[model samples]
Target: MLRTIAMGVLVGSAILLTLIVFRKKLGWAWLSLFGTHLILAALGIYIVNFSGLLTEIYIPLNPATIGAVTVLGLPGVIMLLGLKITLF
Candidate 1:
């Protein structure tokens, strides 16, 4: 709960800073970062409430397996998304 929100905030801030640093040249990157953060935040909530979404199949991948994994994996996904959007 608290951990996920804190981490999301921190990760979001970092992404925001990166976007600011590359404001003019990386508009696409910024948008992707924003999307990735959104995903992370969603995943965080999903994880924290796993018992509730156990049967949801609307999304292909259920990112919220457990708290620790969700907390750690979100940043990885975000980084991958960022890299994919920025590099290729």
Candidate 2:
């Protein structure tokens, strides 16, 4: 699980870094994406690294995490799509 998460994060960071590097050409839309990524990344890092606190605040292995991930992931996905759409 940890290894999987690590691989996912590595891939995500690489993608985000690409966006960040191209933000100048991407323009204002990239700013929105950067903000969304920041929020989701921070929240995800905290939740994954501090599962005990998250479990205490919410529930362990519950739908809330899944829901949050889904919601948060959408923006990043949109950003990636936007990057592709704009660049391609």
User: CA lDDT, every prediction?
Assistant: 0.56, 0.58
lDDT of 1 by residue, 5-87 (tens): 99999999999988877875755776676667657666754553464633432222444433323445666444444444566
Angstrom error of the Cα, residue 58, model 2: value is 19
lDDT over C-alpha atoms for residue 64 of model 2: 49
Q: 1-88, model 2: which lDDT tens digit per residue? A: 9999999999999999888778757667767876776667556545644667324233223354434444567564344334445665
What's the distance in Å from true for residue 21, model 1? 12
TM-score of each: 0.31, 0.29
Name the regions of candidate 2 deviating beyond 4 angstroms.
Answer: 1-27, 53-88
Shift in Å, residue 69, candidate 2: 13
Score candidate 2 by lDDT. Answer: 0.58
